[model samples]
Target: MKPSKNIVLIDSSRPIDRDHLLPLGRLRDLPEQIKRAHTVVVTKCPPEMDIADMFLWEQRLKMPAGIEVQFTTLKYADPLPVFPQEADKRYIYSKFAILLTSIANPRHLRYHLLSFYKISSDLEFRDHHNFSNRDAGKIKRWALKHNKALIITTEKDAQRLSALTQLPDEVKSRMFYLPVEAVLLRSR
Candidate 1:
């Protein structure tokens, strides 16, 4: 299907470090490139995000002076079994859990999980990482120490978890992921 509009999202949870979009004080793209966009959606904003911060991004991205800068957030959803066969059982939210993620930024995912479960530990990997049996061992060790621990991952990471067949059956049995998606915040 042809696209009607183009949208670029910037995570709002973290402050814009460098002058430009790219980090490390680098100039990756021309100001005009970012300004010509039809819409810019800032993602991963915390619940306390304010208008002052929204306007700060508008000025920083070099967007048009009066253009509206809409915001979006990482809205977390229901927890699902990592292994398909275990679908019938409801996730035990009360259990102490370990946060596992290979996304670019995992802070928000960790924050979201803490609201529902006790966070025992975290295993963060590079963005788009392919989990290995070695990595699974670390999670297993952590869960082993923490009684009734659930190893929870993000929805995107859940897709990758299916490919991680080498993980121990023990870990697979207790693992699950909470779905998360970008949701636009109330307009200014």
Candidate 2:
């Protein structure tokens, strides 16, 4: 398929440390991709990951003219505690579905999580360790419901969650791994 002129690519994977950014493999030819991008957004965890450094790298590479690079951090406010109970199951199920299936904004997964999960303005669920089997079950049910169209998730999360055998067949069938690739482009 031809690349969309208005398409926006997002990179939220970890390993952004200075050490990881070196070795040329990570930095090589990135400016070319930036040139092709109309707008590039990097998603990161606030306080933990510094985006300024990434911007500096982009500047050093002399990014393509007119391409805009932006960054947004995902923040956790409060936990949306879920207990394994009959009455709360449906709500919890919906919350899990929203968390796993939706990717409305490439820059802020937290925003999508909050709005889609019906998370109270005061509540936030950031860490993956907070998820329970009950939550996974909900996500499984959602994947089944939606026919699981190649469920797209960050490589880091996929590495962690793909080991769960409890995931339904539908969920597994539709799972698609996203491999990060830098698209190099020549100056116009």
Candidate 3:
């Protein structure tokens, strides 16, 4: 199936991965893909991002003149419990957090959380990681060690973490996920 036009999406949250800015695995084809793109959407950007910097990105990416470039930022909602039944609501207000992430880039979420809480520890996993029982055990142990700190994970990882039947009551009580949605920033 051939699309009428291609829209290339670039994540503005992280540093450029060498020449190709996208987090795709096939690095060689990305530049060509961007060249064919009718519009380029920069995702996960901060709302207050400088307009001049956006133009700089265009030059850095070598985007062809007249190609439309748009910017977007991920807006995060209030923390939601992974296991509502076991969740202790007070943990949501904790001053410290332990971050667990299985996404390609967690820097944006980390930056957001730093505004409200002191991140004590960070646990990172490969993108789309399947949570194993051992992984659950590790998290459970970590929660046990830091009983007062809120255990936070991205909305995507929360799905996999909640599916683990072996997670203890303690872990479930302290764990929460922040839901995120992308909002486009209009060029001034």
Which number leads on lDDT? 3
Q: What TM-score, to 2 decimals, does candidate 3 have?
A: 0.88
lDDT, candidate 3, 1-188, per-residue tens: 99987877766744344555335442546455577878888788777878788877777777777788888888999999999999998998999999999987789999999999999889899999999999988898878778899999998999999899999898898999999998888542
Ranking by lDDT: 3, 1, 2
- Please give each candidate's TM-score: 0.78, 0.33, 0.88
In order, what lDDT does every prediction score? 0.72, 0.44, 0.84
Clashes of each: 0, 1, 0
The 10 consecutive residues of candidate 1 with the worst lDDT sum are: 13-22
Runs of candidate 3 exceeding 4 Å displacement:
13-17, 20-33
Clashes of 2: 1
Per-residue CA lDDT of model 2 for 1-188, tens digit only, reads: 88766434444553233313336535433434546667666545343444566656456546576776655554433223221121122233343332342232333544534454542222123545444577568666655555412244444455655666566554554443233333222111
- Which candidate leads the pack in TM-score? 3
At residue 30, candidate 2 shows an lDDT of 40
The candidate with the higher lDDT, 1 or 3, is 3
lDDT of 1 by residue, 2-69 (tens): 67776655556543443464575333565466565577777778767778877777767777754456
Whole-model lDDT, candidate 3? 0.84
